[model samples]
Target: MAITQIYLNLPVSDLEVSKKVYTAMGGTINPDFTGDTSAQVVFADAIVVQLMTRETFATFTKRSTSDGPIEVISALAAGSREEVDRLADAALAAGGTEPREAQDIGWLYNRAVDDPDGHSWELLAYHPAGGQG
Candidate 1:
């Protein structure tokens, strides 16, 4: 079956604090999917992220959440290098920490930022002609 949407579920220690970080990264909260224990952050119509309290998320599986290590790294494609920089700046201004400096590979640019809960996000922009312009 074809998939119309994708939901990335993450466990957070505090919903309100996590909401601020996601909002800074340009995500909107979907009221229909948000509650006291969990909040649904929508990046676009097709990409939805569900942020649940560790306790609330535990109900879905037996796996224990780990805060000391990153289990996943998420990447978002931007329209331009400027857009990627803007997003990375916003994340840092909103209390997210940068894991490393931005990377420029001629045709591609990328930056990584970690949320307050330590979830890693990579913002990237790619140019087909090596950004000669």
Candidate 2:
């Protein structure tokens, strides 16, 4: 079966802080699927991020959550290099941390940011034609 949508589930330390970071990254909270211990943030119509308290996240599996290590790095595509910078800047302003310097290679530009809970996100703009402009 073809997958129509993607839901990324992450364990967060602070629910409110996670919400603010996602909002700054251009996501909208889907209240219909949100509750006290969990929240659903929609980035695009087909992309949804489920943020849960570490306690609540344990209900889904026996795997342990670690605050020290990054298990995944989620990347999002932007329409332009400026858009990538905009989102990254917004995320940093909303309590996220920049993990590294921005990367630009003529055809692609990207910046990485980590949320308050330490979830990593990469904002990128790719132009297959070799140059952004």
Candidate 3:
């Protein structure tokens, strides 16, 4: 079967605060999917992100919030490594801070940045063919 969409359930401590940060990161609000307690961020027509409250999030997961950065990173693939670098550059210019310069590793190019809410995001470009432009 082919995948037509992807839904990312992200945990947030505060709904209003997270919404503002995501808005700054270029996410558009969809009232059709929003509710009194949650917001659905549409990254693309086929990609949706559900920002769930912490309490609701904790109900399903059995892990505690870590004191340091999250152990795992989530990345959305870019069409090209140049697009990855461009995205990182734009994000940093738009108040996001870069953890480091975009790095290239043969087939992968990636950069990490913290959104306005301090959520970490990796802007990545992955080439399955094992080469870089």
Candidate 4:
């Protein structure tokens, strides 16, 4: 079965702050699927992020909602190196933090940013032509 869409459910300490971070990265809030305790941020037709309060997130899982070590790094592909920089910079200016320095290896460029609650996101661009401008 081909997966038509993806939903990333993240438990956050502060719901409003999380929403702002996502919006800064170019996502739009979908009010139809959003409410007091949870929000749906649409990055693309096929990509959606479900940001929920830690208390609300507990309802969907039997596992603990306690914060811990890094569990996942969500990656987004950009059309070019400049696009990657634009998105990452926007996120940073809107209160997100840079997790590391940007990386550029001719064919690939990437930058990592972390939301206020520590959720990591990597913005990347790949050029198969190998450094071709």
TM-score of each: 0.92, 0.95, 0.66, 0.94
> Please, what are the lDDT tens digits per residue for candidate 2 over residues 37-125?
99999999999999999999999989778766666899989898888889899999989999799998889899999998888899999
Structure candidate 1, residue pairs in collision: none
Error of 1 at 55 (Å): 0.5
- Best of the candidates, TM-score: 2
- Give me the overall lDDT of model 3: 0.72
Q: Which ten residues in a row have the lowest lDDT in candidate 3?
A: 65-74
TM-score of candidate 2 versus the correct structure, residues matched by position? 0.95
Q: Given candidate 2, what's the lDDT at residue 73?
A: 91
Lowest-lDDT window of 10 residues in candidate 1?
Answer: 124-133
lDDT of each prediction vs. the true structure?
A: 0.88, 0.91, 0.72, 0.91
47-85 per-residue lDDT for model 1 (tens digits): 888999999999999988866666789988888888888
- The better candidate by TM-score, 2 or 3, is 2
For model 4, the stretches where C-alpha displacement exceeds 4 angstroms are none
Lowest lDDT sum, 10 consecutive residues, model 2, at: 63-72
Clashes of 3: 0
- For model 2, the superposed segments whose C-alpha errors exceed 4 Å read none
- Per-residue lDDT tens digits for candidate 4, residues 1-133, read 9999999999988888888889988899999999999999999999999999999999999999887889899998888888888989999988899979999888889999999989999999987878721
